[model samples]
Target: MSKLIIGRYIPGDGPVYRMDPRGKLLATFIFIAIVFLANNWQTYAIACGFCLLAVIATKLPLKTFLQGIRPLVWLILFTALLQLVFTTGGHVYWHWGIFSITSFGLVNSIFIFLRFLMVILISTVLTLTTMPLEIAAGMESLLKPLKYLHVPVEQIALVMAIALRFVPTLMDQTVKIMNAQRTRGVDFNEGGLIQRAKAFVPIIVPLFIESLNVALDLSIAMEARGYQDDKPRSRYRSLHWSHYDLYNLGFFVLLTVLLIIFREH
Candidate 1:
């Protein structure tokens, strides 16, 4: 969980960090869509190249980006393994009892791994660069139109922002609880899968209780501050679109068009 950087923000002066939060959010959405549009090596390569460029532009330490990917290593491997074993097409390479490997399977597995990694990396970049408040404000601004339809945009944004903000806090809490459990002779690492899962019960129970307490405290604090869903709130910092935002949006649009033109069906 320490390696999980999904909700943690790193302070940086890079272009990515300086870009408007709304633009970053929109670009991330478009990038996710473009990832699905990639169906072949060429398209994957192009997408990955762009991601690498973005990573470099962030000027963050290479290790930080790698740490973000480390937690998903197992999931990536499992996905690749599934693709290799189940996908059947192209030239047959080898076959065994209920298992076979083919050239297409090999290629497909590689692409799938790359696709997942690319998406994760892009998302990591967004969170690492943008603050939780900025993300919430951006989301609220983007979803503001939904208010005409009676959607609770502010409440939805608040929930999302709170959830994101608590991830690191919860991770820290889990670690502390695990340490406490270890002191009580609970062994989490020395058992089979089921036993290890069972050992986590102590941690999970307390974590859940602690999370509820935190939520209750937050509710009280908000009430003390007179926060209301129906109240008109003003921000000390408002989002301003700059030329850089326009350039970023334009680049993503061009990228989407190129990917659509080059992607294989």
Candidate 2:
């Protein structure tokens, strides 16, 4: 809930931004699979190269991309630590009580760290390049087949759209509350566990109240329009897959096939 992510989207006209969101989402999954397929340093190097090539195509600054990763640094470190301390097979480098470090553990730790970073890096690219509403619309359109099964596709899409819009709004409100508390002499960063828990009360209470008000207002507005969950709805913008989407999807399929083949080896 910081302005940190507010300006996270670096505006640029690039091939990555131009690609269909559905295509990028599918490609990201395939790319993550390739990263996991890597069993050695060589394959990991290839994965890194692929990720770098993707970033280059985005036309966004390297610093901006790296900034998006700052939040996940702790998660990556924790994953590496868990693998290093628990995984045991190869020659041991160190031992103490129930804890031991081995070559296999070290190798696995590195691979796991790389895997986590790669997944987050690719996903961050998706959010950075595409607007949240577009992603929701794309997902809804892609899942249109569910409509024939009596699923509330349009309602689900509306929920996704609202959630996306609320993310930034909620973030901004959190910041405001933090700043207000800070003005009244509150220190969130330098607090002990209990103090920190108490500190969040001020911020969370307001956020909950404000969120409830917004939800009520939205529900009322929807009811005013005779909105029904299962009713058919028309989209202001239609979704269509272009040649680029088809080509990219084919590339992802090929990549997945190659990854599976090489991973088995």
Candidate 3:
């Protein structure tokens, strides 16, 4: 179960790891927009280039990045298959009972599959480099203006931070529980869909109880520390937009403009 989580951070002093989490989040959104907004192969190619550059920037092993996408392989394939069977354009390449494949569908499927792969890869890279706490802080700072609309920005950010902070911990715990069951001759992977799901019941029930207990304890601890919604929060580490962030932002803006121009053409 621990191994199922792909976004675990690996410590490094690389340029990507040194970047402001806020910038990374913004750039990821820009990259996603570039990919999804694309209507042509050229734009997709450019987006792929940008994704490759991001992977290179991270300085992590290529294997690690590829591994991050493994869990998503089935989803990518499923989406591609749906597009291939449903998209109606160009000449039909193959036809069978209640199924047909066309040139347009083939191209669309490949593009969608690649786009999904790139999105996952980019997000995985972002999470692998940035710490969860930094991400949460950056998110809160970025969304601070929303408080003007009477939104509970602090509480939302705190919840996100806590959730992110516990993902790895919970994953580790799940793995331990699975291993303990396996040692008792339980086979999770050998069952049919319903049976496999049933196997999770034992694991999930324990996990849910433990999680509730932890949440209660955390709330009590926060109250004991005089945590209050009316109070302004300060951080030991602040989110700052530096020259590098500006440069990245400029590059993304140019890329977006180019994509728009290409789409018009």
lDDT of all predictions: 0.89, 0.79, 0.84
Could you give candidate 3's per-residue lDDT for residues 120-232 as a string of tens digits? 98898889998888878878888889999999998998899889878878878888888988998888998799999999988998888889998999999999998886888
At residue 170, give the lDDT of candidate 1. Answer: 94
Which candidate would rank higher by TM-score, 2 or 3? Answer: 3
Q: Model 2: per-residue lDDT, tens digit, 106-213?
A: 999999998888787787778788777777887877787998999988888898888877887888999999999999999998768999999999999999999999
Model 2 residue runs over 4 Å out of place are 3-8, 171-192, 222-231
Cα error, candidate 3, residue 38 (Å)? 2.1
Q: Which stretches of model 3 miss by more than 4 angstroms?
A: 168-203
The model with the greatest lDDT is 1
Which stretch of 10 consecutive residues in model 1 shows the poorest summed lDDT?
A: 1-10
Q: Candidate 2, after superposition: displacement of residue 49 in Å?
A: 2.2
Clashes of each: 0, 0, 0
- Against the correct fold, how does model 2 do in TM-score? 0.81
Local error of candidate 2 at residue 193 (angstroms)? 3.3
